[model samples]
Target: MMITEALRLQSQGSKHLHFLIDVNDEQIIYSNQSFINQFSDIKNPAALLPYIENEDLKYVMEKYLACKSGEKVEDFESRVYIDGKRHVYKIAAALLIISTGQHIVGCDAEDITDLKDYINVLNEHNKKKNSILNIVSHDLMGPIGIIQSLSGLLNDPEKKTDEQRLYQYIDLINRTSKKCIALIRNFINQEFLESSGVSVVKKKSN
Candidate 1:
Protein backbone atom coordinates (compact mmCIF):
# COMPACT_ATOMS: atom_id res chain seq x y z
CA MET A 1 0.00 0.00 0.00
CA MET A 2 2.84 2.40 0.84
CA ILE A 3 4.64 1.65 -2.44
CA THR A 4 1.45 2.19 -4.39
CA GLU A 5 0.79 5.45 -2.57
CA ALA A 6 4.34 6.66 -3.29
CA LEU A 7 4.08 5.80 -6.99
CA ARG A 8 0.76 7.62 -7.17
CA LEU A 9 2.29 10.66 -5.51
CA GLN A 10 5.22 10.66 -7.93
CA SER A 11 2.86 10.72 -10.88
CA GLN A 12 0.90 13.58 -9.33
CA GLY A 13 4.02 15.67 -8.76
CA SER A 14 4.94 15.35 -12.49
CA LYS A 15 8.53 16.48 -12.04
CA HIS A 16 9.76 13.53 -10.03
CA LEU A 17 10.55 9.97 -11.26
CA HIS A 18 11.38 6.67 -9.58
CA PHE A 19 12.95 3.45 -10.89
CA LEU A 20 13.58 -0.01 -9.57
CA ILE A 21 16.43 -2.09 -11.00
CA ASP A 22 17.39 -5.75 -10.48
CA VAL A 23 20.71 -5.63 -8.65
CA ASN A 24 22.23 -8.76 -10.28
CA ASP A 25 20.91 -8.19 -13.81
CA GLU A 26 20.91 -4.36 -13.83
CA GLN A 27 17.55 -4.63 -15.60
CA ILE A 28 14.80 -2.21 -14.74
CA ILE A 29 12.12 -3.98 -12.72
CA TYR A 30 9.78 -1.00 -12.58
CA SER A 31 9.68 2.69 -13.37
CA ASN A 32 7.21 5.52 -13.26
CA GLN A 33 5.47 6.37 -16.52
CA SER A 34 7.44 9.60 -16.78
CA PHE A 35 10.73 7.71 -16.88
CA ILE A 36 9.43 5.07 -19.29
CA ASN A 37 8.23 7.82 -21.62
CA GLN A 38 11.72 9.27 -21.78
CA PHE A 39 13.18 6.03 -23.09
CA SER A 40 10.37 4.73 -25.24
CA ASP A 41 12.85 2.83 -27.41
CA ILE A 42 14.07 0.72 -24.52
CA LYS A 43 14.36 -2.88 -25.62
CA ASN A 44 16.34 -3.52 -22.44
CA PRO A 45 17.37 -1.44 -19.44
CA ALA A 46 21.11 -1.59 -20.17
CA ALA A 47 20.40 0.52 -23.27
CA LEU A 48 20.07 3.37 -20.77
CA LEU A 49 23.63 4.57 -21.48
CA PRO A 50 22.62 5.59 -25.02
CA TYR A 51 20.24 8.25 -23.73
CA ILE A 52 22.75 9.84 -21.38
CA GLU A 53 25.21 12.29 -22.87
CA ASN A 54 28.64 10.79 -23.46
CA GLU A 55 30.40 12.93 -20.88
CA ASP A 56 27.99 11.91 -18.14
CA LEU A 57 27.68 8.19 -18.93
CA LYS A 58 30.77 6.95 -17.14
CA TYR A 59 30.12 8.83 -13.92
CA VAL A 60 26.49 7.75 -13.81
CA MET A 61 27.33 4.06 -14.32
CA GLU A 62 30.10 4.24 -11.73
CA LYS A 63 27.74 5.58 -9.11
CA TYR A 64 25.05 3.03 -9.96
CA LEU A 65 27.54 0.18 -9.53
CA ALA A 66 28.66 1.62 -6.20
CA CYS A 67 25.08 1.56 -4.93
CA LYS A 68 24.69 -2.06 -6.03
CA SER A 69 27.91 -3.02 -4.27
CA GLY A 70 26.69 -1.47 -0.99
CA GLU A 71 29.43 1.15 -0.98
CA LYS A 72 28.81 4.87 -0.46
CA VAL A 73 28.11 6.63 -3.75
CA GLU A 74 27.65 10.31 -4.26
CA ASP A 75 24.42 11.46 -5.82
CA PHE A 76 24.69 11.77 -9.61
CA GLU A 77 23.62 14.88 -11.44
CA SER A 78 23.75 14.60 -15.24
CA ARG A 79 22.30 15.67 -18.54
CA VAL A 80 20.25 13.42 -20.77
CA TYR A 81 18.86 13.99 -24.21
CA ILE A 82 15.15 13.33 -24.49
CA ASP A 83 12.97 13.97 -27.53
CA GLY A 84 15.83 15.83 -29.26
CA LYS A 85 16.30 18.25 -26.35
CA ARG A 86 18.72 18.26 -23.42
CA HIS A 87 17.45 17.98 -19.88
CA VAL A 88 19.18 17.85 -16.50
CA TYR A 89 18.35 15.27 -13.85
CA LYS A 90 19.39 14.93 -10.21
CA ILE A 91 19.62 11.24 -9.36
CA ALA A 92 20.06 9.31 -6.12
CA ALA A 93 20.15 5.54 -5.75
CA ALA A 94 19.76 3.13 -2.85
CA LEU A 95 19.10 -0.54 -2.08
CA LEU A 96 15.55 -1.83 -1.95
CA ILE A 97 13.72 -5.12 -1.27
CA ILE A 98 10.59 -6.08 -3.08
CA SER A 99 7.71 -8.16 -1.56
CA THR A 100 9.10 -11.19 -3.49
CA GLY A 101 12.30 -10.98 -1.43
CA GLN A 102 14.31 -9.76 -4.39
CA HIS A 103 17.09 -7.23 -3.70
CA ILE A 104 16.93 -4.29 -6.10
CA VAL A 105 18.39 -0.85 -6.57
CA GLY A 106 16.04 2.15 -6.45
CA CYS A 107 16.83 5.41 -8.16
CA ASP A 108 15.04 8.71 -7.81
CA ALA A 109 15.37 11.12 -10.70
CA GLU A 110 14.17 14.73 -10.64
CA ASP A 111 14.13 17.02 -13.64
CA ILE A 112 15.98 20.27 -12.99
CA THR A 113 16.30 21.79 -16.45
CA ASP A 114 14.27 24.84 -15.53
CA LEU A 115 16.21 25.45 -12.35
CA LYS A 116 19.53 25.23 -14.22
CA ASP A 117 18.38 27.70 -16.88
CA TYR A 118 17.20 30.15 -14.25
CA ILE A 119 20.54 29.93 -12.48
CA ASN A 120 22.38 30.59 -15.75
CA VAL A 121 20.33 33.73 -16.29
CA LEU A 122 21.16 34.97 -12.80
CA ASN A 123 24.87 34.33 -13.39
CA GLU A 124 24.76 36.39 -16.58
CA HIS A 125 23.14 39.24 -14.69
CA ASN A 126 25.88 39.10 -12.11
CA LYS A 127 28.50 39.38 -14.86
CA LYS A 128 26.80 42.44 -16.33
CA LYS A 129 26.57 44.12 -12.94
CA ASN A 130 30.24 43.49 -12.32
CA SER A 131 31.08 44.84 -15.77
CA ILE A 132 29.21 48.09 -15.11
CA LEU A 133 30.95 48.56 -11.79
CA ASN A 134 34.36 47.96 -13.36
CA ILE A 135 33.79 50.42 -16.22
CA VAL A 136 32.55 53.14 -13.90
CA SER A 137 35.49 52.68 -11.53
CA HIS A 138 38.08 52.85 -14.30
CA ASP A 139 36.45 55.74 -16.16
CA LEU A 140 35.97 57.86 -13.03
CA MET A 141 39.59 57.48 -11.98
CA GLY A 142 40.97 58.53 -15.38
CA PRO A 143 39.38 62.02 -15.46
CA ILE A 144 39.90 62.65 -11.76
CA GLY A 145 43.60 61.80 -12.14
CA ILE A 146 43.95 64.21 -15.08
CA ILE A 147 42.41 67.12 -13.14
CA GLN A 148 44.60 66.48 -10.10
CA SER A 149 47.76 66.34 -12.20
CA LEU A 150 46.87 69.58 -14.08
CA SER A 151 46.00 71.39 -10.83
CA GLY A 152 49.36 70.41 -9.33
CA LEU A 153 51.13 71.73 -12.44
CA LEU A 154 49.31 75.09 -12.14
CA ASN A 155 50.08 75.43 -8.44
CA ASP A 156 53.84 74.73 -8.77
CA PRO A 157 55.85 77.49 -7.01
CA GLU A 158 58.60 77.00 -9.62
CA LYS A 159 56.05 77.11 -12.47
CA LYS A 160 58.41 77.52 -15.40
CA THR A 161 56.17 76.37 -18.26
CA ASP A 162 55.59 78.98 -21.04
CA GLU A 163 52.32 80.97 -20.99
CA GLN A 164 51.06 79.00 -24.03
CA ARG A 165 51.75 75.67 -22.19
CA LEU A 166 49.82 76.94 -19.11
CA TYR A 167 46.83 77.81 -21.33
CA GLN A 168 47.01 74.35 -22.98
CA TYR A 169 46.98 72.69 -19.52
CA ILE A 170 43.89 74.76 -18.59
CA ASP A 171 42.09 73.64 -21.78
CA LEU A 172 42.97 69.98 -21.09
CA ILE A 173 41.59 70.29 -17.54
CA ASN A 174 38.30 71.77 -18.81
CA ARG A 175 37.82 68.98 -21.34
CA THR A 176 38.65 66.29 -18.75
CA SER A 177 36.16 67.73 -16.24
CA LYS A 178 33.40 67.73 -18.86
CA LYS A 179 34.22 64.16 -19.83
CA CYS A 180 34.09 63.18 -16.15
CA ILE A 181 30.50 64.52 -15.91
CA ALA A 182 29.51 62.49 -18.97
CA LEU A 183 31.01 59.40 -17.40
CA ILE A 184 28.82 59.85 -14.33
CA ARG A 185 25.71 60.12 -16.48
CA ASN A 186 26.64 56.97 -18.39
CA PHE A 187 27.02 55.12 -15.10
CA ILE A 188 23.48 56.04 -14.10
CA ASN A 189 22.00 55.00 -17.43
CA GLN A 190 23.92 51.73 -17.50
CA GLU A 191 22.84 50.89 -13.97
CA PHE A 192 19.15 51.43 -14.76
CA LEU A 193 19.34 49.50 -18.03
CA GLU A 194 21.15 46.52 -16.56
CA SER A 195 19.14 46.21 -13.34
CA SER A 196 15.70 46.08 -14.93
CA GLY A 197 16.39 45.12 -18.50
CA VAL A 198 17.86 42.15 -20.33
CA SER A 199 21.55 41.55 -19.87
CA VAL A 200 23.41 42.98 -22.87
CA VAL A 201 27.03 42.34 -23.67
CA LYS A 202 28.65 45.75 -24.04
CA LYS A 203 31.62 45.70 -26.32
CA LYS A 204 34.44 48.17 -25.78
CA SER A 205 35.69 50.14 -28.80
CA ASN A 206 39.26 51.36 -29.00
Candidate 2:
Protein backbone atom coordinates (compact mmCIF):
# COMPACT_ATOMS: atom_id res chain seq x y z
CA MET A 1 0.00 0.00 0.00
CA MET A 2 1.09 3.59 -0.66
CA ILE A 3 2.30 5.64 2.32
CA THR A 4 -0.37 8.35 1.93
CA GLU A 5 -3.12 5.76 1.77
CA ALA A 6 -1.84 4.05 4.92
CA LEU A 7 -1.61 7.38 6.75
CA ARG A 8 -5.17 8.32 5.80
CA LEU A 9 -6.41 4.93 7.01
CA GLN A 10 -4.61 5.37 10.34
CA SER A 11 -6.03 8.88 10.79
CA GLN A 12 -9.53 7.54 10.24
CA GLY A 13 -9.05 4.84 12.93
CA SER A 14 -7.31 6.93 15.63
CA LYS A 15 -8.94 10.18 16.62
CA HIS A 16 -5.76 11.31 18.36
CA LEU A 17 -3.53 10.80 15.34
CA HIS A 18 -2.15 14.22 14.29
CA PHE A 19 -0.23 15.07 11.14
CA LEU A 20 1.50 17.92 9.38
CA ILE A 21 2.28 17.58 5.68
CA ASP A 22 4.39 20.20 3.93
CA VAL A 23 2.43 20.80 0.74
CA ASN A 24 3.44 23.03 -2.20
CA ASP A 25 6.01 24.90 -0.05
CA GLU A 26 3.12 26.83 1.51
CA GLN A 27 0.70 24.56 3.37
CA ILE A 28 0.72 22.14 6.31
CA ILE A 29 -1.73 19.26 6.76
CA TYR A 30 -3.20 17.85 9.98
CA SER A 31 -5.63 14.96 10.54
CA ASN A 32 -6.37 15.56 14.21
CA GLN A 33 -9.71 17.21 14.91
CA SER A 34 -8.71 18.17 18.47
CA PHE A 35 -5.62 20.00 17.23
CA ILE A 36 -7.58 21.93 14.66
CA ASN A 37 -10.26 22.84 17.15
CA GLN A 38 -7.89 23.84 19.95
CA PHE A 39 -5.66 25.93 17.68
CA SER A 40 -8.53 27.47 15.74
CA ASP A 41 -7.03 30.92 16.31
CA ILE A 42 -4.30 29.98 13.83
CA LYS A 43 -6.99 29.62 11.13
CA ASN A 44 -4.79 27.54 8.79
CA PRO A 45 -1.61 25.46 8.66
CA ALA A 46 0.51 28.47 7.70
CA ALA A 47 -0.42 30.39 10.84
CA LEU A 48 -0.06 27.23 12.95
CA LEU A 49 3.56 26.78 11.91
CA PRO A 50 4.85 29.49 14.24
CA TYR A 51 3.16 27.88 17.26
CA ILE A 52 4.70 24.42 16.69
CA GLU A 53 8.19 25.47 17.77
CA ASN A 54 8.65 22.55 20.16
CA GLU A 55 11.98 20.69 20.16
CA ASP A 56 10.44 17.38 19.12
CA LEU A 57 8.59 18.85 16.13
CA LYS A 58 11.69 20.80 15.15
CA TYR A 59 13.79 17.59 15.17
CA VAL A 60 11.12 15.73 13.21
CA MET A 61 10.96 18.44 10.55
CA GLU A 62 14.74 18.60 10.25
CA LYS A 63 14.90 14.84 9.66
CA TYR A 64 12.02 15.07 7.19
CA LEU A 65 13.89 17.78 5.21
CA ALA A 66 16.97 15.55 5.10
CA CYS A 67 14.83 12.63 3.88
CA LYS A 68 13.65 14.82 0.98
CA SER A 69 17.31 14.93 -0.20
CA GLY A 70 17.38 11.05 -0.36
CA GLU A 71 18.63 10.57 3.21
CA LYS A 72 16.87 7.83 5.25
CA VAL A 73 15.28 8.96 8.52
CA GLU A 74 14.47 6.51 11.32
CA ASP A 75 11.47 6.57 13.63
CA PHE A 76 11.69 8.48 16.94
CA GLU A 77 9.64 8.70 20.15
CA SER A 78 8.56 11.89 21.91
CA ARG A 79 6.08 13.04 24.53
CA VAL A 80 3.37 15.58 23.70
CA TYR A 81 0.51 17.04 25.64
CA ILE A 82 -2.86 17.46 23.91
CA ASP A 83 -5.90 18.93 25.70
CA GLY A 84 -4.00 18.80 29.04
CA LYS A 85 -3.29 15.02 28.84
CA ARG A 86 0.21 13.76 28.16
CA HIS A 87 0.69 11.46 25.20
CA VAL A 88 3.81 9.54 24.20
CA TYR A 89 4.07 9.11 20.44
CA LYS A 90 6.30 7.17 18.07
CA ILE A 91 6.69 8.99 14.78
CA ALA A 92 7.78 7.57 11.44
CA ALA A 93 8.28 9.56 8.24
CA ALA A 94 8.95 8.81 4.59
CA LEU A 95 9.50 11.00 1.56
CA LEU A 96 7.30 10.68 -1.54
CA ILE A 97 7.88 12.11 -5.00
CA ILE A 98 4.61 12.77 -6.81
CA SER A 99 3.89 12.60 -10.54
CA THR A 100 4.51 16.37 -10.67
CA GLY A 101 8.01 15.56 -9.28
CA GLN A 102 7.28 17.40 -6.05
CA HIS A 103 8.86 15.81 -2.97
CA ILE A 104 6.52 15.52 0.04
CA VAL A 105 7.10 14.14 3.53
CA GLY A 106 4.58 11.61 4.86
CA CYS A 107 4.59 11.28 8.66
CA ASP A 108 2.71 8.90 10.97
CA ALA A 109 2.39 9.07 14.77
CA GLU A 110 1.18 6.38 17.23
CA ASP A 111 0.21 7.09 20.84
CA ILE A 112 1.94 5.02 23.55
CA THR A 113 1.10 7.05 26.69
CA ASP A 114 -0.51 4.18 28.55
CA LEU A 115 2.51 1.90 28.08
CA LYS A 116 4.88 4.62 29.28
CA ASP A 117 2.76 5.26 32.40
CA TYR A 118 2.73 1.55 33.27
CA ILE A 119 6.50 1.35 33.00
CA ASN A 120 6.89 4.42 35.25
CA VAL A 121 4.72 2.82 37.93
CA LEU A 122 6.78 -0.39 37.84
CA ASN A 123 10.00 1.60 38.22
CA GLU A 124 8.69 3.41 41.33
CA HIS A 125 7.61 0.12 42.91
CA ASN A 126 11.07 -1.38 42.36
CA LYS A 127 12.74 1.64 44.01
CA LYS A 128 10.57 1.40 47.14
CA LYS A 129 11.20 -2.37 47.36
CA ASN A 130 14.94 -1.82 47.25
CA SER A 131 14.79 0.78 50.01
CA ILE A 132 12.77 -1.53 52.28
CA LEU A 133 15.19 -4.41 51.66
CA ASN A 134 18.13 -2.26 52.69
CA ILE A 135 16.40 -1.25 55.92
CA VAL A 136 15.45 -4.84 56.77
CA SER A 137 18.93 -6.24 56.11
CA HIS A 138 20.57 -3.63 58.28
CA ASP A 139 18.11 -4.20 61.14
CA LEU A 140 18.34 -8.02 61.11
CA MET A 141 22.12 -8.46 60.90
CA GLY A 142 23.08 -7.56 64.53
CA PRO A 143 20.42 -9.75 66.18
CA ILE A 144 21.13 -12.76 63.96
CA GLY A 145 24.89 -12.52 64.62
CA ILE A 146 24.33 -12.33 68.40
CA ILE A 147 22.08 -15.43 68.29
CA GLN A 148 24.74 -17.35 66.35
CA SER A 149 27.53 -16.39 68.76
CA LEU A 150 25.50 -17.22 71.87
CA SER A 151 24.53 -20.60 70.49
CA GLY A 152 28.16 -21.41 69.66
CA LEU A 153 29.39 -20.48 73.15
CA LEU A 154 26.63 -22.55 74.82
CA ASN A 155 27.52 -25.56 72.70
CA ASP A 156 31.29 -25.52 73.46
CA PRO A 157 32.08 -28.51 75.76
CA GLU A 158 35.20 -27.11 77.54
CA LYS A 159 33.95 -23.55 77.92
CA LYS A 160 30.52 -24.63 79.26
CA THR A 161 31.94 -25.48 82.71
CA ASP A 162 34.55 -22.68 83.01
CA GLU A 163 33.30 -19.78 85.16
CA GLN A 164 35.68 -17.20 83.72
CA ARG A 165 34.91 -18.26 80.14
CA LEU A 166 31.21 -18.28 80.94
CA TYR A 167 31.50 -14.70 82.29
CA GLN A 168 33.42 -13.64 79.18
CA TYR A 169 30.77 -15.26 77.01
CA ILE A 170 28.12 -13.38 79.04
CA ASP A 171 30.02 -10.11 78.41
CA LEU A 172 30.12 -10.84 74.68
CA ILE A 173 26.42 -11.66 74.73
CA ASN A 174 25.70 -8.39 76.56
CA ARG A 175 27.72 -6.36 74.07
CA THR A 176 25.98 -8.07 71.12
CA SER A 177 22.58 -7.51 72.74
CA LYS A 178 23.40 -3.79 73.04
CA LYS A 179 24.33 -3.79 69.36
CA CYS A 180 20.95 -5.31 68.52
CA ILE A 181 19.23 -2.52 70.48
CA ALA A 182 21.31 0.09 68.62
CA LEU A 183 20.34 -1.49 65.29
CA ILE A 184 16.66 -1.16 66.17
CA ARG A 185 17.20 2.49 67.09
CA ASN A 186 19.03 3.10 63.84
CA PHE A 187 16.18 1.49 61.88
CA ILE A 188 13.68 3.76 63.61
CA ASN A 189 15.78 6.84 62.79
CA GLN A 190 16.03 5.73 59.15
CA GLU A 191 12.28 5.26 58.98
CA PHE A 192 11.73 8.79 60.35
CA LEU A 193 14.17 10.21 57.81
CA GLU A 194 12.47 8.41 54.95
CA SER A 195 9.03 9.52 56.09
CA SER A 196 10.18 13.10 56.26
CA GLY A 197 11.89 12.87 52.88
CA VAL A 198 15.25 13.57 54.49
CA SER A 199 18.48 11.72 53.84
CA VAL A 200 21.04 10.54 56.39
CA VAL A 201 24.36 12.28 55.87
CA LYS A 202 27.67 12.22 57.71
CA LYS A 203 28.80 15.54 59.11
CA LYS A 204 32.19 16.89 58.02
CA SER A 205 33.59 19.60 60.29
CA ASN A 206 36.62 21.74 59.55
Candidate 3:
Protein backbone atom coordinates (compact mmCIF):
# COMPACT_ATOMS: atom_id res chain seq x y z
CA MET A 1 0.00 0.00 0.00
CA MET A 2 2.81 2.37 0.85
CA ILE A 3 4.57 1.56 -2.46
CA THR A 4 1.35 2.23 -4.32
CA GLU A 5 0.83 5.58 -2.55
CA ALA A 6 4.41 6.63 -3.07
CA LEU A 7 4.28 5.75 -6.75
CA ARG A 8 1.02 7.61 -7.14
CA LEU A 9 2.43 10.74 -5.51
CA GLN A 10 5.59 10.52 -7.59
CA SER A 11 3.58 10.10 -10.76
CA GLN A 12 1.36 13.08 -9.93
CA GLY A 13 3.99 15.56 -8.74
CA SER A 14 6.98 14.27 -10.68
CA LYS A 15 5.67 14.12 -14.20
CA HIS A 16 9.20 13.99 -15.58
CA LEU A 17 9.99 10.90 -13.51
CA HIS A 18 8.58 7.53 -14.59
CA PHE A 19 8.36 4.01 -13.22
CA LEU A 20 8.41 1.78 -16.27
CA ILE A 21 8.46 -1.63 -14.62
CA ASP A 22 7.84 -3.07 -11.13
CA VAL A 23 8.82 -6.66 -10.68
CA ASN A 24 9.04 -8.91 -7.67
CA ASP A 25 12.83 -8.79 -7.69
CA GLU A 26 13.73 -5.61 -9.57
CA GLN A 27 12.30 -2.49 -11.22
CA ILE A 28 13.10 0.00 -14.01
CA ILE A 29 12.81 3.73 -13.64
CA TYR A 30 14.04 6.88 -15.37
CA SER A 31 14.07 10.54 -14.32
CA ASN A 32 14.94 12.71 -17.27
CA GLN A 33 12.93 14.97 -19.55
CA SER A 34 14.42 13.53 -22.70
CA PHE A 35 13.82 9.99 -21.47
CA ILE A 36 10.20 10.78 -20.68
CA ASN A 37 9.65 12.36 -24.09
CA GLN A 38 11.26 9.38 -25.74
CA PHE A 39 9.02 6.91 -23.89
CA SER A 40 5.84 8.85 -24.62
CA ASP A 41 5.19 6.53 -27.55
CA ILE A 42 4.46 3.67 -25.14
CA LYS A 43 0.71 3.48 -24.59
CA ASN A 44 1.14 1.74 -21.25
CA PRO A 45 3.88 0.64 -18.88
CA ALA A 46 3.21 -3.03 -19.60
CA ALA A 47 4.19 -2.44 -23.23
CA LEU A 48 7.69 -1.50 -22.07
CA LEU A 49 8.56 -4.96 -20.65
CA PRO A 50 9.33 -6.70 -23.92
CA TYR A 51 11.28 -3.65 -25.15
CA ILE A 52 13.52 -3.78 -22.06
CA GLU A 53 15.02 -7.02 -23.39
CA ASN A 54 18.10 -5.08 -24.40
CA GLU A 55 21.35 -6.61 -23.18
CA ASP A 56 22.38 -3.57 -21.23
CA LEU A 57 19.03 -3.25 -19.48
CA LYS A 58 19.08 -6.96 -18.77
CA TYR A 59 22.46 -6.59 -17.10
CA VAL A 60 21.23 -3.60 -15.12
CA MET A 61 18.19 -5.51 -13.92
CA GLU A 62 20.29 -8.49 -12.84
CA LYS A 63 22.63 -6.25 -10.86
CA TYR A 64 19.70 -4.38 -9.36
CA LEU A 65 18.16 -7.64 -8.15
CA ALA A 66 21.45 -8.82 -6.71
CA CYS A 67 21.86 -5.58 -4.82
CA LYS A 68 18.38 -5.89 -3.43
CA SER A 69 19.35 -9.37 -2.19
CA GLY A 70 22.13 -7.70 -0.11
CA GLU A 71 24.79 -8.06 -2.78
CA LYS A 72 27.02 -5.09 -3.63
CA VAL A 73 26.28 -3.46 -7.00
CA GLU A 74 28.76 -1.25 -8.79
CA ASP A 75 27.61 1.53 -11.10
CA PHE A 76 26.57 0.34 -14.56
CA GLU A 77 25.55 1.73 -17.96
CA SER A 78 23.48 0.43 -20.89
CA ARG A 79 21.76 1.41 -24.11
CA VAL A 80 17.95 1.64 -24.22
CA TYR A 81 15.25 2.59 -26.67
CA ILE A 82 13.17 5.69 -26.18
CA ASP A 83 10.17 6.24 -28.48
CA GLY A 84 11.46 3.51 -30.82
CA LYS A 85 14.75 5.39 -31.23
CA ARG A 86 17.87 3.87 -29.74
CA HIS A 87 19.96 5.87 -27.30
CA VAL A 88 22.90 5.19 -25.03
CA TYR A 89 22.01 5.66 -21.38
CA LYS A 90 24.28 5.86 -18.40
CA ILE A 91 22.24 4.27 -15.63
CA ALA A 92 22.67 4.07 -11.87
CA ALA A 93 20.44 1.93 -9.65
CA ALA A 94 20.13 1.57 -5.90
CA LEU A 95 18.09 -0.58 -3.54
CA LEU A 96 15.66 0.85 -1.02
CA ILE A 97 14.33 -1.24 1.88
CA ILE A 98 10.79 -0.38 2.85
CA SER A 99 8.83 -1.66 5.85
CA THR A 100 7.64 -5.32 5.80
CA GLY A 101 10.85 -6.46 4.09
CA GLN A 102 9.79 -5.03 0.74
CA HIS A 103 12.65 -3.83 -1.46
CA ILE A 104 12.37 -1.05 -4.05
CA VAL A 105 14.90 -0.32 -6.76
CA GLY A 106 15.47 3.29 -7.87
CA CYS A 107 17.01 3.93 -11.23
CA ASP A 108 18.24 6.98 -13.09
CA ALA A 109 19.22 7.39 -16.75
CA GLU A 110 21.12 10.04 -18.71
CA ASP A 111 21.15 10.35 -22.51
CA ILE A 112 24.63 10.37 -24.06
CA THR A 113 23.60 10.44 -27.74
CA ASP A 114 24.89 13.94 -28.39
CA LEU A 115 28.17 13.26 -26.63
CA LYS A 116 28.65 10.07 -28.62
CA ASP A 117 27.87 11.84 -31.89
CA TYR A 118 30.40 14.58 -31.11
CA ILE A 119 33.09 11.95 -30.44
CA ASN A 120 32.31 10.17 -33.72
CA VAL A 121 32.61 13.42 -35.68
CA LEU A 122 35.97 14.17 -34.07
CA ASN A 123 37.25 10.67 -34.90
CA GLU A 124 36.20 11.01 -38.56
CA HIS A 125 37.88 14.41 -38.87
CA ASN A 126 41.10 13.05 -37.41
CA LYS A 127 41.09 10.12 -39.86
CA LYS A 128 40.62 12.45 -42.86
CA LYS A 129 43.37 14.79 -41.64
CA ASN A 130 45.78 11.87 -41.20
CA SER A 131 45.04 10.67 -44.73
CA ILE A 132 45.69 14.13 -46.18
CA LEU A 133 48.95 14.47 -44.21
CA ASN A 134 50.13 11.06 -45.48
CA ILE A 135 49.50 12.13 -49.07
CA VAL A 136 51.26 15.49 -48.64
CA SER A 137 54.28 14.00 -46.85
CA HIS A 138 54.87 11.12 -49.28
CA ASP A 139 53.89 12.76 -52.59
CA LEU A 140 55.56 16.09 -51.83
CA MET A 141 58.69 14.65 -50.21
CA GLY A 142 59.70 12.59 -53.30
CA PRO A 143 59.58 15.50 -55.77
CA ILE A 144 61.29 17.87 -53.33
CA GLY A 145 64.09 15.37 -52.73
CA ILE A 146 64.57 14.90 -56.53
CA ILE A 147 64.83 18.70 -57.02
CA GLN A 148 67.46 18.98 -54.26
CA SER A 149 69.48 16.07 -55.69
CA LEU A 150 69.45 17.53 -59.23
CA SER A 151 70.44 20.95 -57.86
CA GLY A 152 73.44 19.36 -56.08
CA LEU A 153 74.43 17.52 -59.32
CA LEU A 154 74.25 20.77 -61.33
CA ASN A 155 76.35 22.64 -58.72
CA ASP A 156 79.24 20.19 -59.29
CA PRO A 157 81.42 21.77 -62.00
CA GLU A 158 83.01 18.37 -62.80
CA LYS A 159 79.58 17.01 -63.80
CA LYS A 160 78.70 19.73 -66.35
CA THR A 161 80.49 22.53 -68.32
CA ASP A 162 77.33 24.29 -69.67
CA GLU A 163 76.98 27.43 -67.49
CA GLN A 164 73.62 28.52 -68.98
CA ARG A 165 72.06 25.04 -68.47
CA LEU A 166 73.43 24.87 -64.92
CA TYR A 167 71.91 28.29 -64.14
CA GLN A 168 68.53 27.16 -65.57
CA TYR A 169 68.58 24.00 -63.43
CA ILE A 170 69.49 26.07 -60.33
CA ASP A 171 66.62 28.50 -60.98
CA LEU A 172 64.12 25.64 -61.43
CA ILE A 173 65.32 23.97 -58.24
CA ASN A 174 65.05 27.26 -56.28
CA ARG A 175 61.49 27.93 -57.53
CA THR A 176 60.29 24.36 -56.80
CA SER A 177 61.95 24.28 -53.35
CA LYS A 178 60.43 27.65 -52.43
CA LYS A 179 56.97 26.50 -53.53
CA CYS A 180 57.23 23.26 -51.47
CA ILE A 181 58.39 25.17 -48.38
CA ALA A 182 55.53 27.67 -48.82
CA LEU A 183 52.97 24.88 -49.10
CA ILE A 184 54.26 23.19 -45.91
CA ARG A 185 54.30 26.46 -44.02
CA ASN A 186 50.77 27.30 -45.12
CA PHE A 187 49.51 23.88 -44.03
CA ILE A 188 51.20 24.21 -40.61
CA ASN A 189 49.84 27.74 -40.12
CA GLN A 190 46.30 26.68 -40.99
CA GLU A 191 46.49 23.74 -38.57
CA PHE A 192 47.74 26.02 -35.79
CA LEU A 193 44.99 28.57 -36.43
CA GLU A 194 42.30 25.90 -36.40
CA SER A 195 43.69 24.39 -33.19
CA SER A 196 43.74 27.80 -31.55
CA GLY A 197 40.15 28.46 -32.55
CA VAL A 198 39.05 25.13 -31.11
CA SER A 199 40.90 25.81 -27.86
CA VAL A 200 39.29 29.23 -27.55
CA VAL A 201 35.85 27.78 -28.11
CA LYS A 202 36.43 25.07 -25.50
CA LYS A 203 37.66 27.64 -23.01
CA LYS A 204 34.58 29.76 -23.58
CA SER A 205 32.32 26.75 -23.10
CA ASN A 206 34.02 25.80 -19.85
Best by lDDT: 1
Query: For candidate 1, which ten residues in a row score worst on lDDT?
Result: 197-206
lDDT of 1 by residue, 45-96 (tens): 6788877999998888888778887765445689988778999998878877
Range of the 10 consecutive residues with the lowest summed lDDT in candidate 3: 14-23
Please report, in order, the local distance difference test score of every candidate based on alpha carbons: 0.78, 0.62, 0.61
List the pairs of residues colliding in candidate 3: none
Regarding lDDT, does 1 or 3 come out ahead?
1
Most TM-score-accurate candidate: 1
On lDDT, the stronger of 1 and 2 is 1
Q: What is the Cα-based lDDT of residue 194 in candidate 2? A: 57
* Model 3 Cα lDDT, one tens digit per residue, 80-148: 665577666655555666677666655555566556555655676577679769877986897699797
Give the CA lDDT, 0 to 100, for residue 197 in model 1. 52
Model 2, CA-based lDDT: 0.62
Question: RMSD to the native, candidate 1?
Answer: 5.7
